[model samples]
Target: MGRETYTGDVAFEVRGHLGMITLNRPKALNALTQLMCESILIQLQDWAEDPTVAQVLIRGAGDRGLCSGGDISSVYRDMLEHQPRDGGGLLPESTPSYAAAMPAEEFFAVEYRMNLTIAEYPKPYIALMDGVVLGGGVGVSAHGSHRVVTERSRVGMPETTIGFSPDVGGTYLLPRSPGNTGLHLGLSGIHLTAADAIFTGLADTFVPSEALEELTQQLTEHPVDEVLPRYAKHPGDSAVEQDAEWIDAAYSAGTVEEILVELEQHSSSYPGAQQAAAALRAKSPTMLKVALEAIRRGAQLSLSGALAQEYTIAIHALRSHDFREGIRAQVIDKDRTPRWNPGQPETVDEDLVAHYFTPVPGKLLSLE
Candidate 1:
């Protein structure tokens, strides 16, 4: 089959009837931009019906990361320059619209739809997940028909760290995590190893980093339906199984505060859990609480339902005081100190948190 490069930034090739798209921004560790998201979405649609393209493989260019995340630094800069900074301290204003008169809202709308499309793709889709799969990265890879990871894979739903409740279908996937494991990961932004990824049901297979090229070759040579069984002969239990005790104990807490207390108390006994709790403590407490609620609610909804719910929370979060502040502190100012409202988890009230879940007018997600 022929090969083509879209915009030259992303490499698209068809080898052995498998359409492969590689995120090419290795310098930025393949951090996704709006352009990249749009390109990939369009390509997926084009190839989905191509009779010659029997399977699709999505991967990163370099070894650093599969895709780091959305271009947050750009998003923060845009928010500060154009939009009116809502001073009422309830929700922040929406992001400035792009030239097509489409705001960040449309960006998210299309991005989420792309995510669902990958999840439900008619043809087999494989994600070669290596390092630093966060936020937007998770949206693309986690929902694939087959997600393959290496020991270097560092996966997470880390939206809380940036003052956003997990977007890009994180709300849906995080809650679906076994038991409360989803809740814990969503709130804390903890990174998971390859084993952890498979254990949590986020990845389908684990292979050593050295075996990646060989595996890619195999996928190219074989039919999509035959690849999994051929690769299933590897060793090692899933990541979750290795950390079962700690995950179950630390995540079982009823509330975010309770989870922190338990983690602090058990830090000496479980270093990983303790470190995770400490990390959560460092993030915006309000964001953490919202993330928890999002995950819990998302777990119960269908994929389309979850995306619709997340759209409301996302638009509301855009107008939140903590979001802009979080972006300022974390990305723009690089101050590393955010003046969060309800700075502590206990200070946030149920009604205040409820505002984020309020539905937007005519904001239904299209999952076609």
Candidate 2:
């Protein structure tokens, strides 16, 4: 009979039996923060077992979409101000990412945990993913039981552009793609349209951007299982699927370097593969290797296991110069040119990539 009370960037309330969550940061593209993440986690955890709450729905304010990703500006600032006593070596590792004292440490730890919660949630979890659903946006919406994408949806995990690997269970999500398309997308950081998202299994159904509000209202009135089917409709043909043959062949190579070599050999015939190869070439060498390894390893592991592995990579990657430089160029400086320290992929050898997998002192991620 009464609406639930909540405060912070994430707005939560109960409309009838529908538990509603609105990402309140329109200007920031609803970029996720620890507070937003924690609020979401708590509400979802409570609603999961509440019989009165029949389902959950999450969306973003403004036209931008569900969420852009984690607060990378804060992460960039932290990296700049962080004076490592060990000289870019590992921090104390009181937690998964940093020493217990570090404020940013809890961000991913909680965020990853929240992602896991959505993945494991028993009740129906619906996400209204629209407009610029990249990085952190993918994490929130991709795991939902009913992932609703719009005609305006533009989704991708473009972390490699900023010298970061895809995290928040990307390792699990990417490898599950039908073919080497996952590897190609992971390495290239290209955005996918609504049709592409459904083809790639990132989203379930397509609902027009204008119709989403009506759908939400319907969810409050009827069961999601009933209301969703009424609105779900086919978007269109996917352009990403056109390149499936090339992606399978190029990304079939075990490593990013091998993939690049394959792309290079075919560059004369397939301009698309050539362009994909060039995009990979422009990304951070260390991150390319890390992203490759993450997906490869994730194929064999559970969702929780993948999150744990990513936690290790994110913390270790903080030591690298590319992360800070990538952020400066893309976020702070607004320049597209990020001068990667090891510009060439060849320079980032296996040993260097191994450092990211090395565990820290504090507790790692666990759904159990």
Candidate 3:
């Protein structure tokens, strides 16, 4: 049999019984695009049915890491040029048409579906998370049965910082993180170390960055379950573990207001908590409330259910001033100064928060 040919930023190659995937755009930190998601999903789906394929391995090219996340700049542009939909009467006058928005809407809808695929993939999906893995990057790597991280790994769902809540299955994944640390990370947009990733259940094994090449070579020649074990090393100290007590105390409150208050109370003795609180203050308040609620609801729901809830919030967020402004400052303008509308977390009323979960007037996600 002859080898199949493929091309683009995402590439696939079959080596012996192993199928391998590479996110090739190292310049942008391998930021995912719709094409990459489609490539990954198609390759995995194909590999799942192929009996000759023992397992699959995925990694990013370049030294930076696996991937940063979805291409937010592309998504933001879609929202800006978005047209109206459903006879154009459903959305508010000021709100962008979530139904009509190109790319971002389609991106999330497709990206989330891809995430579910990984979560339920039949064969072993080994991810080499050697660098900055965030947003959509997490969706791809975190769901796999055998997620491997390196000392160079830095991971998180930093949607809040971009004036957006974490999407790409973050609603499902973050809540599942250990001891309310998920909530703390989701709200604060903090990056976790490889050791912390293992502690938080994000990655299964810890291997040195340099060992990845040998691991890949071994995977190409043998079964992943047998090969990965030989190279696995103990991921040393986890900062998140040391701070878990402080996190659960500060972030477990019922509301964002209460959470911030608790963080303030601990500010004197735990400067980390104080700093975390201050970081939360810089993000969109409306998003903060919505993110917390989504995570809480996610803890109780299945992956599909959590994804459904997140879709609603993502649609609602497009209508908010913050999401747009957040992207403009942090991404477009590169100013790092997002003038949040509500200014304070307490000012965002519960009623506004409720609107996020309201049924979106468009096609529903076909997760099954």
Clashing pairs in model 1? 91-319, 92-319, 92-320, 195-239, 196-239, 199-240
- The order of the candidates by lDDT, greatest first, is 2, 3, 1
What lDDT would each prediction earn against the true structure? 0.78, 0.85, 0.83
What stretches of model 2 exceed 4 Å from their correct place? 84-101
How close to the true structure is residue 112 of candidate 1, measured as C-alpha lDDT? 84
Runs of candidate 1 exceeding 4 Å displacement: 82-89, 92-102, 228-243, 362-364
lDDT of 2 by residue, 1-368 (tens): 64866856988889888999999999999999989999899999989878889989999998877888999899877776664422332344353345533456668889999999999989889999889898888899899999999899998999999999999899999999879877877889999999999888899999988899899988987988899889888989987798788888888898878989999888898888889988998898889988998899999989999999988887776656777778889998988998886778877667778878888766465567
Task: Give all TM-scores, in the order shown.
Answer: 0.90, 0.94, 0.94
RMSD of each: 3.0, 2.6, 3.1
The per-residue C-alpha lDDT of model 3 at residue 135 equals: 83
Among residues 3 or more apart in sequence or in different chains, the pairs in candidate 3 whose N, CA or C atoms overlap within 3 Å are: 65-131
* Candidate 3 lDDT by residue in tens digits, 84-138: 3222112463444554555676677888888999889888899999989988889
The residue pairs in collision within model 2 are 69-136
lDDT of 2 at 32: 96
Please give the distance, in angstroms, between residue 300's alpha carbon in candidate 3 and its true position after superposition: 0.9
- The window of 10 residues in a row where model 1 has the poorest summed lDDT is 93-102
